[model samples]
Target chain A: MSEPSGLESLYRELILDHYRRPRGKDLAPTFDAESFQVNPVCGDEVRLRVKLGAASSDELGGTDILGQVTWTGTGCSISQASTSVMCELVRGEDLGRVAELEAAFGRLMHSRGLGLESEADEDALGDAIAFEGVAKYPARVKCALLGWMALKDALAKAVAGDSSPAPGPKG
Target chain B: MTGLSPETVTSPTNAHGLCGPGGLPDLGAPREPITPQEVERIRRDFPILARKVRSGHELIYLDTAATAQRPSCVMDAMTWFANNNYAAVNRGAHLLGEESTEAFEDARARVARFFGATPSEIVFTSGTTAALNLIALSLGELAQGEPPASSAVPHICPGDRIVVTQAEHHANLVPWQRLAARTGAELAWIDAGPDGRLNLESLAALIDSRTRVLAFTHASNVTGAVTDVARLVEAARSVGALTVLDAAQSAPHLPVDFRALGVDLAAISAHKMLGPNGIGALYGRREVLEQLPPVFTGGSMVEIVTMTEATFCPPPGRFEAGTQPVTEAIGWAAALDYLSHLGMDRLAEREAKLTARLLDAVTGIPGVRLLGPADPADRLGVVALDIEGVHPHDAGQYLDDRGIAVRVGHHCAQPIHRALGVRASTRASVGLYNTEAEIDAFAEALANVRPYFGATQ
Candidate 1:
């Protein structure tokens, strides 16, 4: 039998807490940018809406500080919790830091559950580090990255000055 | 897709232990169910089942519906063929080529024999998907315009109708949809009832004189419910429509006799039946096959080639284009021989018992909802279930952690899952070699899933 800790590493209490009462699990009536993504293999989906507070003409999506990042979707714990954690991490933060954290999280997921080398990166990941065990499962990596993909897409739409929300989910 | 039959769900217990695969007295088959000893002996043929996974837990394989594990004999047969008779079949005048061609033809003969059909009726393809696509593509070509003088392919006129079922896998459904779109034919379907069974009441309206084709599955991959092929075939025959059966799931667990089923065309996969991958067969009635237009045209399948045009070979040869998976064919023939030796009737009985046990175990869990029929007697051992308040991925991971491999997804049949009110599901299917104990272990693990994920609510 696998050690209880093996599963625990992936389904951390913090992660479970987020999954049980997900953060930003609601659609905003109005948002500057919105994107929906579905992991077709398992059908874990997330639609994220980001409201950028200010645009300082930073083409890199850096000057726009996300005033709010809300989402709504149905999926597994890993995907739902990852979305919750991502929403919490990016809210009130500049798109530049969000991008850096997204990059850092991507590295963490690619770590194959061994975690990252630098303590700085791990610290930056916060509760998101709990998903380290998910990387060992290549199939679940998309679950952890679902929210990030939607965020990236929404941010791209915002940066491109496209204010329209997609009518439905996309894979 | 049905309302929860929780009343049928019992305590997470092994009802099969009291009377397992030893013998299925109630089954109408004259053959006996494979005994526990027989199951053990069968397991010896498949070495992968003995391997450990995820922190050294013994592998409890319950995902046979996705793809069956190949026995050592199958691999050995392919290897032996590769070593001794590996050559371009029907090409060189060399001894190896002659032997290779003979072996390839022999494989076709064996597959045909197993399905109670003649060698001329079997057309080799990559898999069932390819087989169905071949049929649809040929029909599409015929719909477009006239083919060679020899071709007698069915025409799908602009207003003609093509009827399928709601429970068809995308492989079976999409090709027909595309065929309908290309031919300007209206695509209709028999809806699945709340119980996940085909609502045959809609069949009268959907299938009419204008119906050029009626394609459906012999057994649903999602629901595990075996279709009443006779009724469907009778209806199609009444309208003089071409009937295409997707036998991918049925050919594995059921003793699928194409002649007995009376379908004009059928597709089957070998990998799902403990044979090698990348090899399958399309079975057509001898006359039907003779008339069907070839989907693929190339070197091996032609009769004579000219600078501008080439006449095609008859039936099976006409359909098999280019180089074939000769080694895989040999392996699949060996697999058929293995199944033949065991008797498909006996194996089917054994599988029925296991399905009963599996259904009993999975549906017993509080929140688990079966995606198929509750009765195991008429269904295959393929069970796809949804655990409420818990996603299939999480459920699948929990099972995987315990070394119980299961399929977790829409399983390439998204429409059925949607009809069942779920985006995805976890399926635990059984093969002939599976035991009652494994089903218990799966159930025990599955029972804890709700609490483990805190999804009891």
Candidate 2:
């Protein structure tokens, strides 16, 4: 058989698995802050609730830990898959580490179909590396970045003592 | 390659260039649907039709409802006008200015003739959105209980109601909503049936003495259901209400006679009819247009100007404010000439067959649900579909990858989509130049969407 095309690479079985049976797909009844994000171009939406736990004290400035991340959304497979993979990767991580990973993924997207150079950055993104092909399509990058942007907004709202984060367009 | 003859490729230029100036072509009786060979010849005139997309796949553009592709002659006209006769219209005294002004006015007369109207009744605006906005704002001014002493139209008071259909494109719908809000008039709508057809049976109950204006679409951009204009006109006339038809979607595909339809006013965009962008025309009955107030006021649209006040020009000029889209108007006239030669009735009949083929192919899929009438005769070639387990954006992407470009989302008619119980849908609309092969490719590509998304059983 001929080698799989870029579209096939973008819709890998692992990505489809997360999209079809998403983890943390339910809304949390109680959360510190909640954010609803929408992709106006395609009308995809995600409402995410984030809970922050006590910060770890080992570092000079203790980084807040993510206690739970849950969301309810309706969107295309790329967005759904990105959100599910994000929840799996960052649920138990420190906020600082999550930010680092988010930044790394952003860099991967900006690479424009050329993925991360270092294995370390690939490891940081984990299954999100599957979205590297998706980033090639400038029109669809918003779909892949919806969840991460929502997470950042919800965290900011939680820090500001606001109960609801404003919904925003990511791309 | 079709290896089209050189004669057919240059026909639009010859037909338009040599036609007698100052007289409309008597486009005889409605012709039959074009044969396959005729379609091939028509396709040769559009350069974009020959191009390829991703990995050498041929481009199948199925998004004409969003915006129709321009024929080579339309582009040529715009370029030729801009390069040869570019000057400010109706203002300067230079030779070039007079030439530009003459070309611009000639275009207006051409557009008016196309719609069975007089040049005095056609007002050029930026596009359909601007044209509709001009009407709504002007009507809002009229409804404010004040008519200039020179105007003869009656005032629309607080208790008046403005009626519209749920199927109107946002351009037509939102402006009326705003007009009602500004004038304190009641805003009401005629809802669509289960199959996305407008419920004309409810018109008598909806329109009464208090109804001042009844605005609606000639054909829906999303559902493809052509409105029953005769019944709508009869009902609106019975109530003595002004009827405003949004012919943006219909004028390109069908023959639209404003006089025969007997509507008080209408709006059509050149870009949606295989013309240049940034140009639309508003058609009004001469007597009715004379009374409508100007929404926008500025330089070229005035009759007399003082330090403190200004008197407006005649009907068409009164509504057109500021520097107009002069070149776009000339391009629009050329575009009209192109469509008139092609014969709108023949194009409509051809599109009906293509609509049937698309409906059959898409609806035959096990999980596909069409948003409009199942009878292809009731619809045009605009087909919006909702797959059971695929988002329209995803379906759109799959089609795009296969070099089939279709429109996705609410199509700017959110209420109709909500009424049809879908947040968004995938639409495959056609233009005069589209082929049966493209329709088949669209259907074949759509069948693979569910499997690609891993949603198929």
Candidate 3:
């Protein structure tokens, strides 16, 4: 098969821009809860830190939930950009709602099920949709998923409150 | 730009079928008897050489260390065998089966002769990794008191030493490591010099009376530095240690005579020498092989079997436990024949000239640091280099943009890279068909790498 051109949709300028300057790339000074995640296939790593605050949501009765989420890690552009978009979408949401968001993101990236319908609230995942082209390149799918997988692990750790640190990148 | 267009001038094949009776085209002939023209004709025999990548750019394959392109003769031989003589060897009573067995044995005989050993001593393996693993497991069995009934063999104790080199590829290193872990034996390593060549002086110290096996590579897959097998064999012999030579790289490029080298056992791969993948051969001295217990046992290897007990065949068959890759063996034998026809001496000479050209070109390029011997005489046509301020992966990507293929990363010899004080380096390895023109093109591409990366050369 012919190699995909560098200027094509996969290597789009926006992806390179995100790779060069990733947003939401910082750790909370004192995270109420945090988790470390890694993509074992490749050596991409990410640490997801969440801060729970006593802010009530109109949709739910007065109850404290995770108020902010931030991430810091090293990985390829797809992974980093995906995590950036993920952090932006899930921030200020209740901790109980994380499972649904994770499942939705997994379906989109892995191409296993239907994607979420376009809505004004879904604008946070703008850069991540750029990676829909990556599903075609099976060898590179892992590269795109490195960050999101790390987030999954980190979230699990944060829920457990036993976060030391994840294993370092393997050779 | 002349009366004849550039396209016409470039069409050397159309003007004179290079492989036709007259001989190859003269594109700066070499001092070797096999001129540059002859090499081009030889290159034409390998159909894969004509392939293009990245639009119209010709494929400049330099990853022979990973796998070599097969010549038409090898491919044709394998095709003929599968189409005409396909049958189960050794076990069948039919005519086709017997014919297939004879052909298979004939291939074994050819391999034995290629390495200057008896047919009985050659064991067909999946590849060099399997051969090395077989040797390691067999030795482990012997060390653990799983010996044949006829003779009692010495068992390895906790204090016994298995000597290996730090420069060894993981194939040579990992099995021994596992063996040491299992047997409680100490694994001693011989260090490589700053130039990446094996330090034979240190190897002498490493092999003492307690050393039961001395394993080392005939050539470093990463550095391309050939080892002094004579010195190593002598050192191991003085300590009464059986020697295992990893000839995966050397056998493909040079004239390897296992009998003359006097190693107890040697392993080589077929794919590295322009043959099909999934087949390799292990050469063991007849007496030594007879003494060693089989690593695997089943099917064709058994002499006779009862519910309670079984008798095994000797040497090659004893080690060969399963149905073999018959087509692959035939292909490898054909590859050997092609190499023989070219004459190893002539092939080596051609490669030496190309190695010199590559060495000169890379050395002249600023910011490029060669990993092994700066002089081409001390090395094969494999050059591993680090371009200053540019990671090997980025450098490899730049070369890839130009249709030039090279291996990046640690090249699966992490210890060597660690010893050399680098995370990874890009490598360009040559095969029989590589030309000086390709080397020049490689150098030109490499020259553009540092600048492209915005690194000062």
Show pairs that collide, candidate 1.
none
Highest DockQ scorer: 1
Model 3 CAPRI quality: incorrect
Give lDDT tens digits, candidate 2, residues B188-215.
9999998899998788788999988899
Off by over 4 Å in 3: A1-4, A7-124, A128-137, A169-171, B1-32, B146-154, B364-368, B387-394, B450-457
Predicted candidate 2 versus true structure: per-residue lDDT over A1-171, tens digit per residue: 232375676677888888889989998889999998888877899989999887667762676788899998889888998999999898878888888888888888788887788789998888789888887888888898999898988988887889854456422
What is candidate 1's DockQ? 0.72
* lDDT tens per residue, model 3, B216-330: 9998988899988999989888878888999999888899999999899999999999889999988888888888888788898999899998998987899888898887887
Candidate 1: regions farther than 4 A off = A1-3, A55-62, A169-171, B1-32, B147-153
Tell me the TM-score of each prediction against the true structure. Answer: 0.92, 0.93, 0.83
The per-candidate TM-score of the B chain, in the order shown, comes to 0.92, 0.93, 0.91
Off by over 4 Å in 2: A1-4, A55-62, A117-120, A164-171, B1-32, B145-154
Question: lDDT value for candidate 1?
Answer: 0.84
Best by the lDDT measure: 1
Taking candidate 1, what TM-score does its chain B reach relative to the real chain B?
Answer: 0.92
Q: Sort the predicted structures by DockQ, highest score first.
A: 1, 2, 3
Q: By DockQ, is 1 or 2 better?
A: 1
List, residue by residue over B50-118, the lDDT tens digit for candidate 1: 899886889999888899998777776677677767888879877777777777887888899889899
